[model samples]
Target: MGRPRLGITSITLVKTLFLAALDAGAVYFAVVLAWQGSWGFLSFLLLGAGGVNFLLLSHKAYPLRYLFPGLFFLLLMVVVPVGYNIYLSFTNYSTGHILTKEEVIRVLTSREYAPTPPVRFPFYAFGTPEELYGVVLWPEAGPLLLWPDGRLASLEGHQVSDTDADGIPDVLDGRPRLSGRELLAHYGMLQALRVPWENGWLRLATLREFGYFLPQFLYDPEQDMLVDQRTGIQYRAGESGFYSPDG
Candidate 1:
């Protein structure tokens, strides 16, 4: 055909090396995002994939050198972070160790609140699939109320009492249901609802107050400690994952 292509194997080897570099770079940035909990991890991953696509299609476009800058960026952002995390995994990087113990302890002792009883309400969800917008509630005890906007009214001919505070009467008489943002707002109403669903009411319970509950672990920078709300215990990094009452 065209002077019989020569050095084809060498060209293939160069292409392989470039692709491998891109893959390695992508993996690196992905790990970095995970470690740092950085916001742009997804962005870096996308960039890496884009780089691979660019390299693959470089020959099809004019001025192939234009793609080199992008390839360089992918290597720096993705490959470096991945390699760093791999290095971290080999050492005592977990709890009681230098780098991660504090965060581990903080998570073990976060505070949590139990929603009060009478929690269950006949509920529905709404919004444009992207964001949860709002909710409306009819209690089984108090009133047929649309919440969030606090729009309240009595459903015509339907009586709200101890049995059916949630205004959708036991008898369905063709009432148009709440939708859109109104449904999204229902979650808050679900939490705020004082009605008992089965047996438990939502209450703020920590080992410090209620003996039978647990806390969500969150970091307390000032105290320099991890508080376990479940067991009513606090663990310090120096204590090596052990929390004693006296300590």
Candidate 2:
């Protein structure tokens, strides 16, 4: 009588169980890397190698010579990348560190903005039924509305002229006007505008020409600090995190 033999079904079941466990582990690590978003290229290379390894290991009848070629490919894919990463960790590698002089200069220079004399003003919003609108400036100078003709209304000094017969100034030259939803259809062109605010400026922060966003805090590069205009406090960045300027 032949020795008792294990069924082929049992062997297949064992293979399936091993592959399932491998797949679960791969999925768990992938999720962790995705959440961190820092693994960078190594994550992609490993996932590819894992796929190839699965394919090779599942083939039950491969000769040893064929296995050597697959093993070589697997090493090339996995081992080479890890060696490269270990090499990079010891070198000077950072945003500006790797950059050439010209590239570094270009980046450093692009962050500057025109320090226009600060202009601050109190702004009120006017919305139209068509989702278009404009801002009315009070105690400053004029009203800037998104005109139906795809132009900006010059209501600044026109606080007296009745350009429109709606009992309001045709523009700012007349009297403060109410051009809310009535003029919303033209708001598509009402891109964000940087209007002079009190000693500084108020920026239109939306495409709809609605809300205003002011730089409530000022960043001083000279001192490497951020000053909160509202709270009258300064903060600085450091190795631990942002901390009060006093510390």
Candidate 3:
């Protein structure tokens, strides 16, 4: 042998730190899985992570690392999905009903419709371009103040003022609002925002406006059917996993 390595060498220290970080992430995900009631997937994750950790730590199991990567991928990608598909075969799983009854109802009821002559609100952002603190919606009705965290506040409480008199409020709660090119940087966060409006929601419709929308379908649990508000047609869930028009 050329040289013998010490137990607590720099390479060993780096390995220890890497493993500790990996374990921390595993614990965090394990807690999330437990909270979400994903027990089977959680068990697989715990067992797989535990095995990897043990194999890497124990000197006797060093040789297994060469074969471990392939085995891990095989079980995770191929075995788990195959097992889940087999489990689904016993139930009424098909194209339309891939999800549970409650899930299907939730999806249908969540669909939205944009009203004719849509009320488009011009809004302005507050805080740094990288991250937004709040926004002011200027609809014809009135001014509305809202935060990215999904909380709405009164415009009066924010000490609002239009410094440049550009129609869009320039200052709110002591923060100068972002405009033009600066506002574009906050696109990722703003796109996913949904604010409750009337009986439905108002969402980011374009770069310049937030559009008000209404619920497209109303789910009646007592009748187990979805009623289309626009067409006034009722569609009932059938055994074939599709919602056919009620006769």
- Residue-level lDDT of model 2, residues 1-247, one tens digit each, is 9898879888778867877777777677777777777587547746664764566475553465367676777778998788888888888762236766445334533332323343334444444354334455434344555333334456544334555675443434222434544544544444434444334444443432233334545666677666665566876656533368578
Query: Judged by lDDT relative to the true structure, which candidate is superior, 1 or 3?
Result: 3
User: Which parts of model 2 have CA positions greater than 4 angstroms off?
Assistant: 1-136, 140-160, 163-167, 171-182, 203-214, 245-247
Question: What does candidate 3's lDDT look like per residue over 1-247, in tens digits?
Answer: 6687666687788888988988898899999999999998799779878887888899889989898989879988999899889988777564444687788778878898887878789888888877787888887778888789666667875687888887667777788888778888887777888898778788899897888988889987788788888787888867744365645
lDDT of 3 at 68: 92
- Candidate 1 contains a number of clashing pairs equal to 29
The order by descending lDDT is 3, 2, 1
Top lDDT model: 3
Writing each residue's lDDT as its tens digit, candidate 1 over 1-247 gives 5786659788778877887787787778877877888756667686757755675657775465576787677868998889878877786664345636645655454345444341334433323334433232334465343333434344455433323565333322323344444434334444443322332232212211111122444446677666554454665545455455586
| TM-scores of the candidates in the order shown | 0.30, 0.37, 0.58
| Deviation in Å, model 3, residue 13 alpha carbon | 42
Off by over 4 Å in 1: 1-90, 93-102, 105-133, 138-166, 169-175, 178-223, 237-242, 245-247
- lDDT for model 1: 0.49
Model 2 lDDT, residue 69, Cα: 73
